[model samples]
Target: MGHPTPAAVWIWMFPLLLLESRAGHLGAQETEMLEGQECRPHEQPWPTALFQGVQLVCGDVLIDDNGVPTAVHCKKLKYTVRLGDHSLQNKDGSEQETAVAQSLPHPCYNSSNKDHNRDLMLIPRDRASLGPQVKPIHLADHCPQVGQKGTISSWSCVTSPQENFPDTLNCTEVKIIPQKQSEDAYPGQVTDSMVCANESSGADPCQGDSRGSLVCGGVLQGITSWESDLYGRPERSGIYINICHYLDWTKKTMGSKG
Candidate 1:
């Protein structure tokens, strides 16, 4: 697909903003990959599925001290995280499954709001088995500036909702968009706690991609919160929970929780 102009990007994102209620949950069955490429083994180990039985809702993994960081809204449902597995259907021996002993959503998380600021939660596992294929990622010390590039990885759908989720992991590169652009697209909803990124061609996170990791310079910069479109349109950008803005909260939360 051809790249979308900034004006087109904003125009397309506007209507999506109004669908925030249905857009927020970003259901697993309706998610798609939208122009992303398959990820190589071990290229992104920090992203794992937050699932209840066979159903995948979002992506998550160990961030610090066996704590798994994901979108706070996912806390509403119970999940067992599977790490080191690329294919959700077939798992290699490298995969390790663990039950969540407890969850701690950021104290400031407000589900009633649409911006989804502080959209993060930490799930602590009692006996997590870590190895090369399953390890913790470092949280970024600073938020990426506008125009910086990052890679987002997930195992969600590779096409429209009519298709099945990919058996292998998928990844795509995205550039940080200017805050003003995000503000214009999202209006007063955009906040300091959120960051925005897009591809000129409109590649972005879609449904079932929430809580996925956004990595820049080998650091975990953000977590997928929501996107502008449900069908994985190439003209829309995605919003992420800025890890840098929540560094203190993360540290304190992880330290306090068992």
Candidate 2:
């Protein structure tokens, strides 16, 4: 799973997005964590690493054991879930790595169709243990307001022509903006389920940075979905699936674990 790239148009390209059409670019998106500083060890206890076996696929949120795994991009393949990981290359001994028994993708997530909403999933494992360095975050109850400040945690590292997928976590500050920007940038692809944001501290999101958390007012409000290249067009904004819009679905879907 990775950030969406230049489509001549805008797209919320799959990091864990469930589209075979989108999976082809996963290798390119895996290049680096976008421009940002390193996150303190375990500071982002809610993020989990998703791997198609040994290879890293994307980063997801750990809301208890009910982590938000997005997309059925590879519907046939299962993922290895790793939590409490500060460094991907070097384990700090606080990591909880396990294989999930099953991944419950949103029943409505058929990205092959005109549907891109409901991309998140509730993953369960036979034995999933939480730790001091691994914890759950509560999803924001309300939609994010325009101009609201938030923090985006990313593992992507993209500094212009240089690209390196850093082992450590990274985070940057962001702000919610009007959806009109999304509409202007992405055209017909923008949906009400999605919200828009712009970089306030670091550079705009890139590959290896999406599908992570967008926390506002201290709650998980959204997930990184896509962005247009703002290198020249600074008016363009990144898109995130507003968690508040899907709160009912997530809770009901997660059921007892929620």
Candidate 3:
């Protein structure tokens, strides 16, 4: 469940809609994961929720004690991270909030209106203490293969796209699609820095799914990259930045930071 359709976005979470209007760096339709199922109370804990003041901004994954990656467009937000958070409406007492120490978006990130090349950013774990409910995932050493199955986790508003957002974590299974196929969907915008995925059953969103992370075979494989609104369309595909492609930069950034 991801990527907000403009026609359907107004009916989703209010805070997300407001955030998109301001930056829209991930694109207008790239906000919320669509048609996702809620996780059990505190079932999965690696995903983190980012916020600007009180507004929900983006969903991120903790890759290490000192690194959590998200979209570069989210840079302007008053950065704060919520760990061990499963519910958005109700506090389950597992939630722990911490201010981000700093962020380093890719220096080569292209900010063109139509192209979102290298749209990844790294934020340190900061002062948040780690525990059972709060842990980091390992980064992918090898690139994800085509047709590989992966799970995407995000703070989605698909089920209750209205005044109230769902109170649990949302995630869905997606398969990595061929680069050529994704190329056809995105045209010249598809680059080596990016990868594509699709929810085979056509159950959920096809693009960027709003900064959601693509985890394959138990490791962080890709980060969602925003794209056109392909919701309800016959061709189903989602764009993601291949995390393995930027392994060097990620390590350097994390190692050089606090």
> What is each predicted model's overall lDDT from 0 to 1?
0.76, 0.68, 0.74
Over 4 Å off in model 1, which ranges?
1-33, 113-115, 160-164, 230-235
Evaluate model 2: give its lDDT. Answer: 0.68
lDDT of 1 by residue, 117-170 (tens): 787888877655767788788989888998899998876556654545677788
Q: Which candidate leads in lDDT? A: 1
Question: Candidate 1, residue 177: CA error in Å?
Answer: 0.9
TM-score of each: 0.80, 0.77, 0.79
How do the residues 193-220 of candidate 3 rate in per-residue lDDT, one tens digit apiece? 8887777545343334453678899999
Ranking by TM-score: 1, 3, 2
lDDT per residue as tens, model 2, 1-258 = 875558722445444455664665675554433446787788778887777777777666776565554544423366687788878888778888777667777777777774557666667644446677878778887899999988777665545335456677777777888888778777787799888787743355663245366888778887766655554356666677778877887787777545
